[model samples]
Target: MELKKSTQKRHQLLNAALDVFCLYGFTGASLDDIAKRSDMHKSNIFYYFSNKEALYIEVLTSVLQKWLESMQMLNVDEDPEEMLTKYIESKLEFSRLNPKASKLFALEIIQGAPYIQTILKGSIKKHFRGKVKVIAQWQTQGKIAADISPELFIMNLWSITQSYADFETQFEVLIGKTLRNRSFYQTAMKNNLQLLLHGALVK
Candidate 1:
């Protein structure tokens, strides 16, 4: 019972910390702010996480692992178009479901990832390249179109969708509506992705 309670408290603190960090960012956030947001004592917060960096890293690693699970389910055996569509849909879904996590990730990358640069350089980069290699193989085997560069294709796709989360204000202004309370934006996303894919696909 004690172990369960301890685990639950740590999870609660981490969740609250994620939100506070997303709003104020790494340099802007403090333990007191996180403790207040979490409704937990400052000492209790420290019990689970020694410092801000430890908590931030845990939140990041948790989100990164979830994102990676989503990536792993990409299903290479499916038809390339369906596979690509699923990948895009999942990306949008991740943004929708974990906006704070997404926001913090965006902020970290935007600020040059002072703390987690190694993650971006190592595991993330390796997995990303592996996906690109899969795309390249698909193209070589005529699964996807042969003309486009797999790496550039992924770069474009990531930019377009990540752009939505990273610059939500810009998206809202340009589209004249918020997608958060709206479902129509999803179809728009699908259509825009299709249009881009049309140019890249051989057919």
Candidate 2:
């Protein structure tokens, strides 16, 4: 029971920190703001994280993990079209559900990813390459277009799906409704699947 409470409190702190960091980038965010957001004392943050930088990194890592998990369904064994369709749907759903985290991650990347560069170059890179390898395998198997570049395909997928989150305001303004709207979300999912699969899949 005590451990559950402790874990809950830690998650609360991380959630509050995510909101604060999204509003103000890493350097701009302060522990006091996070504490206030979490309704905890400033010193309490130290119990979970060693310092501000540590807390910031933790928040960023959590966001990245969630984003990566959405793409983990991609694999060589699955039907290419089915796997890609599910992957696109999952990415869109994540964008709708975690827009702030997505935007925060984009902000960090735009700022050169100073804090998470090592993780990006290591585990993230390895994971990304594994997905790329899956796409390449699909291409080699005549599952997708032979001319498509696996790395560029993956990069384009990220750009399209994440744009819905990173540019939520623009999307809402232009579409007159957010991705939260069921009809709009379905439209988005269908359109994205068409745009991506139509170009890559073998007809």
Candidate 3:
């Protein structure tokens, strides 16, 4: 239908925008670059977005939504080890598959998140607090260490997993292999799970 095609075209635009933004950062990226990347005329971008800022916000919002969805796997009722394992794997998988998107997000935050600060403080904060409450519930259930700070634990997990994307060049230099390799990915998942779970899981 027309709606389906419209949605598809919107997604194509967002995908192209993501690549351009990641390569050039927000200030450096231009609508012409995104249009060229999407193989559409620059004027066509206005059909879906009001302006360059609007498109950039949409692209950033989409990436953040995907990142938050990865954490939805966590459940207080599930075994802590199993849930944490799945969470770590999901995050790492996202980093591996969408490294550029991950780096773009990191760059946004590093630059003080000028465009998405409202979203970060509103929906993103609420979502993060909900997950922290889940972690606290796990601790109360004696699933993880009571002494572990839920906020800090979540922050650390995010930093470590996202580092693989935001610092891919450094990782490549040190590991001598990209995460594209199955072996490297497995090693990353295993080590991340171990490093994280070892400290938090109740003995």
Q: For residues 1-203, could you state the per-residue lDDT of candidate 2 as single tens digits?
A: 99999999999999999999999998899999999999999999999999999999998899888768867899899998988888888888888999989999999999998999999999899989999999999989998899999999999998999899999999889878879898989898888999988999987
User: 82-131 in candidate 3: lDDT tens per residue?
Assistant: 88888888899889999999999999999999999999999899889999
Worst 10 residues of 1 by lDDT: 70-79
Steric overlap count per candidate:
0, 0, 0
Residue 11's lDDT within candidate 3 is 91
User: If the candidates were sorted by their TM-score against the true structure, best first, what order would they fall in?
Assistant: 2, 3, 1
Local error of candidate 1 at residue 87 (angstroms):
1.0
- Estimate TM-scores for all models: 0.90, 0.97, 0.96
Query: Ranking by lDDT, best first?
Result: 2, 3, 1
Candidate 2 — worst ten consecutive residues by lDDT sum?
A: 63-72
- Which numbered prediction scores highest in TM-score against the true structure? 2
Pairs of colliding residues, candidate 2: none
Better of 1 and 3 by TM-score: 3
lDDT for 78 (candidate 3): 78
lDDT digits (tens) for residues 1-203 of candidate 1: 99998888888898998988999998899999899988888988778877889899889989887767766644556577777777777777677667788889989988989878888889888878888888887888787778888888887877676666777777678876554855756775767578657876666
